[model samples]
Target: MESGPAIFAGAAFTLFGAALLLWTGVRARQGEPVALGVAPRAAVALTTLFGACFLLLGIWCFGRL
Candidate 1:
């Protein structure tokens, strides 16, 4: 695998995941919906899960490089 593309993708995933996680936290703190029309708890859980998965995948990609 090319280091340049891997690095770019890894960075993108990491940033996106971090944004999702941070957004969820900020919205939860303000009593806003983490996802529109979804239950607060479920939305938070789902968003967090996705964020974690993305973060892990990014880390894995970076490790490969």
Candidate 2:
């Protein structure tokens, strides 16, 4: 497998995931309003889960590289 593209993709995923996680953390810390329909806790949980998935995917891709 070509490590170049994989590494780039992994870095992108990691950065995006980190950004989402940071945003969620800031929102929670600031007691900001969450999106409609979902409860505050659920929203945070979902965001965290999504961010974790992305982070893990990125790590796996980086490992491949």
Candidate 3:
């Protein structure tokens, strides 16, 4: 696959993950539930991991491009 598309897709994924993290934070501030059936700490860990993956992937793709 071309590095351009991969870079673009990776950037999109990273942004989406960032948006999710931001939403999660807003919900937490409002005293709302973070995730169904998941502990708050675990949910945060999962979110951080997910976002980190996207960020790293995007960086890698950008480097390749």
TM-score: model 3 vs. ground truth? 0.71
Provide the lowest-lDDT 10-residue window in model 2.
Answer: 29-38
By summed lDDT, the worst window of 10 consecutive residues in model 1 runs over 31-40
The TM-score measured for candidate 1 stands at 0.94
Give model 1's clash tally.
0
For residues 1-65, what per-residue lDDT tens digits would candidate 1 score against the true structure?
49999999899999899898999899999998888888889999999999999988889889988
Residue 30: error of model 1 in Å?
Answer: 1.0
Candidate models: Cα lDDT each: 0.91, 0.90, 0.77
Residue-wise lDDT of candidate 3 within 1-65, one digit each (tens)? 59769868778876877777787778778877778899987887787778677777767766776
Off by over 4 Å in 1: none
Superposing every Cα of model 2 onto the true structure, what RMSD results?
1.4
| Number of clashes recorded per candidate | 0, 0, 0
Q: How accurate locally is residue 4 in candidate 2, as Cα lDDT from 0 to 100?
A: 87
Q: Between 1 and 3, whose TM-score is larger?
A: 1
Query: Where does model 2 exceed 4 Å of error?
Result: none
lDDT of 3: 0.77
TM-score per candidate: 0.94, 0.89, 0.71
Q: What global local distance difference test value does model 1 have?
A: 0.91
